[model samples]
Target: MIYELNKSHFYKVSHLLTGDLVNIEIKGVVQGYQPGWVFVEHIDHPKTAMIWSKAIDGFYFIGDENNTDFNDYINQFISLDIAPRAKDLGLISFEFSGTSLSWDKTLESVFQNRELHRSKQFTYKYKNIINASIAEIELQNGFEMMEVNVFLLEKKLSNLDFVTSMILDWWDSLDDFFVSGVGFCILYKDQIVSCCISSCVTDDAMGSHTVTLNDYRNHGLAKKLIHQFLTYCRDHGFEPNWDCMEENLGSRLLAESCGYTKDSEYILYHFKLY
Candidate 1:
């Protein structure tokens, strides 16, 4: 029997789900910040065949899902009408991770009538970089890497518009990096121009985000923030990592400059709610 997991199971499952950026929100799930849920074949039993976690309009699946029971769990949950409620959000995506081979069969066994399209996304991992990384080259004419307090999440929240909203929404994960001084921002006389934060980190790989005020584009601030973020990863145990939709050339180039290359890609299955 498949059981819906409670927050208590977070610590055990978080590490397993974190390799992907969306799954890293497992931090919010464990911290009780939002309505996140996980389903597993066995409740208290160790090492069950499959586990599924519900993300906003999408879901993330992890575990050794090569077995038939994994397919059974999908049918069992959908039979309970999980589909209609999930699809009510319009369109939803399912992202699968890890070395599981039976995904095509498993999906076929369940959604025989639904239309699903497969798309690929790449995530880069750092390889063969020196011990210390330089955070900035020459600050461009208009911008400078201003000194921002590491623990001042509130000041940023009250001052900026877009970045503030993101920080407020995902405070738990951002706070983990904020308190550690793992990010930086550019300033131009009191108005925050560009900023970067270590978005998420696992034992092995670290994820990042960069933003700049609209008027401040082409000022080389994004790279400066990224270089700083990568440097922190160098000193720490985590590998500098980046991931984006396959179409985002800007993100791809940014990662390339830091000596990172495309390491792994995942398939995203998109389904319409109609």
Candidate 2:
């Protein structure tokens, strides 16, 4: 049987569960989570048993094999083209591989539109890139580049002009991006032209999310802003980790330019309801 946990002990319960910290988005929620649901089996002694759990906009399971009734949970979580809960919940997606065959297979069958994606993950430790910085570009003569605190700006959080994708929407759902996130941008005429920032984070890793105005591409603004962001990470004791679809060559090249090297590939399983 599964049951919801009291909000008071989320931190305690999270510490008790041993699992992957790679998905920094999920890590932040688990570590100092908000009022999201945390359903677990074996309520009486959850830590003593292999557990199955999911938080809002989070991975379905960790620390154990997936439960048998995941389909029922997905059904309760969403319906055909409509969500009865969590407005602004643009999309909920999960990725896994050989280790989570059961949950992977289950979601593939439950969701209607399934897409198999691949991302070449990369990492850059502070030591390897302390001297790395962005070179000036001729087109950037009138632009200003700087970092901004996402947690403090409600306007930016709700800004529709920049929130073009579901991932950006997910960043907005975060109660506070500063909890485990960072951001930087290039402002041209007070509008974001190019930017690079962490959309999700853990204690030691910041998940990379970067963007540039389509019209401003090839100006090298992303590399400039991201290199500075990496310098900030070096000073703060965090490493920037990245993952993008295998076919996104431009993204791959930008990562390489900023001192990141290919590390591994992940099978990202996306299930979207249209």
Candidate 3:
């Protein structure tokens, strides 16, 4: 029998299950945070089943427990009329200690390369790396200080705007990094100028992060915003993570400039949904 999970219970249990890898510190309608949801499985006994949460509906379980049965769970909780169709699901991990690292066969297949291996030297460098050129633009007359807002939720896809929707999509598609926080633009005269989203996760094992905007390109806003987020993460016990498609020159240059060493490589997979 599936028991309804409350906010307090889900928060407590998710931390216990993932060993604090998942955090529920933002405010939202649900018990956790945006784009991520947690559930406890009671197979045979409610206490014995593994606890699982998905950030951006991409990967279902992290830190080991049988994920083979996730489809069954999806079928059980999601109904055509009540839930969004299952788009994709998979697993990914990063090791920050070395240049060589080994990923699962599934990851290699997703990246479409067979030479990817798990070693200290291979793990810290990003495979299929991409670098992007930085554009410089002067701020308007009303630009001011930067700020960050972190929200916790108990459900998925809460009241998000158009830009937030794109950010969530990007987070779902990218496996080498994870969303660390969302940032809003500040104006010199106290008016809002732009907004950006940032992430924290490793490529192979090296820490990195990135920030992106909607229509505010060609400005140095992203660089400053990402730096603020990185500083926050570092101060809060998280190592920054950065990675991108091999062809994404803009992202690569940004990461490298921010002191992210291209240490290792890995693969990202998208499962076909029927």
Best by TM-score: 1
Model 3, position 209: C-alpha lDDT score? 34
Worst 10 residues of 2 by lDDT: 47-56
**Clash pairs detected, candidate 2:** none
Error of 2 at 177 (Å): 2.9
Every candidate's lDDT:
0.58, 0.52, 0.38
**Model 2's lDDT to the true fold?**
0.52
Q: Return the TM-score for each candidate structure.
A: 0.76, 0.65, 0.46
Q: In angstroms, give how far residue 31 of model 3 lies from its true place.
A: 11
Better of 1 and 2 by lDDT: 1
Two-way TM-score contest, 2 vs 3, winner: 2
Best by lDDT: 1
- The RMSD (Cα, Å) of candidate 2 is 6.0
Mind giving the per-residue lDDT tens digits that candidate 2 earns over 1-274?
A: 4455565544545644444323444454555522244555556445312121122253434434445543345444444312333334544444333224454465555554546553333333333544555354444578876565543243343332563342344454443555555677777765767766675566766656777878888877877777677777777767677656677887777777777877655444434433
Off by over 4 Å in 1: 11-36, 46-57, 76-101, 128-132, 146-158, 169-181
Q: How many steric overlaps are in each model, in order?
A: 0, 0, 54
Instruction: Write one digit per residue (lDDT tens) for candidate 3, span 1-274.
Output: 2333554555444333332222121111123333444344542223312223243333323222333343235333433311333333433331111111222432343333223333311112222233322233455555554443333121132233433444554344322223334444433343333444453232112232333335456667666655555555544544445546566777778766655666545433333222
The TM-score that candidate 1 achieves is: 0.76
